[model samples]
Target: MQTKLRSRTITKPRSHHGKPAQSLVARRLPAKRPPTHPGEMLLEEFLKPLGISQSAFAVRLGISFPRLNEIIRGKRRVTPDTALRLAHVLGMSADFWLGLQQDWDLWHALRSKQAAAIARLEPLRHVS
Candidate 1:
């Protein structure tokens, strides 16, 4: 099973005020909804289509069925160890799984109520 990954170079457009426009990441984020959880991707893209039972896949991954189920249900984050195991079994790079998890995490973090305070933080100026 080959998954085609596409890479693109994004050009940042400038606003009329000469400031950089919203980033590609920002544009892709849904306004009122969280992005697709990585677990959903794993279930939809790999497990169901491949007809792999959770118990069997968990055995193959050398993990417990509950642990695998938690991941599939989005109740658990895909850690580095899980990513590595998934890569070894799925033939995809660990980075792919980790990246999806990161994106999901960052999107939620940015949308939280504290995000406004985070945005207000100023960078320290360097002493030349």
Candidate 2:
């Protein structure tokens, strides 16, 4: 059976040190926004170093292979816990993961909001 995938939304905030707080995504601005999802980069980098398949990586991350696949495909959002776990497993800086996620969330949220706004404006265009 095909499972329904839900996009995850981050509500809480964290600190540079991984401390739980409010709006970490906001606190770390411009500089924190990465050029791309670090997880995707990390995943590729990690996979090369580990010499394992997606299933193996998923096992190491304590997530299902499909879920891991979703993350890689940009279909699923990465959570803080998952980011931390990745940092631990892949020997990457935890803050890097957090920054990537924060950046991804910010851009995705803004783009989505913009698209919705544009969509609303389409009907008005037809009426004009």
In angstroms, the error of model 1 at 113 is 2.4
What is the Å distance of residue 33 in model 1 from its true position? 3.5
Error of 1 at 123 (Å): 1.2
What's the CA RMSD for each of the models? 6.7, 14.4
Per-residue lDDT of candidate 1, residues 1-128 (tens digit)? 11222554444433345666444253244456787788899999999999999999999999999999999999999999999999999999999898888878877876668865655556668989
Give candidate 1 misplaced runs (Cα > 4 Å).
1-32
lDDT of 1: 0.78
**Top candidate, metric lDDT:** 1
What's the CA error at residue 82 for candidate 2, in Å?
0.5
lDDT of 2 by residue, 36-126 (tens): 7755876676776778788988998899989888887777777888888888887877787877777777766644546445433423245
Q: Candidate 1 has which clashing residue pairs, if any?
A: none
Off by over 4 Å in 2: 1-34, 114-128
Q: For model 1, where is the 10-residue window of minimal lDDT?
A: 1-10
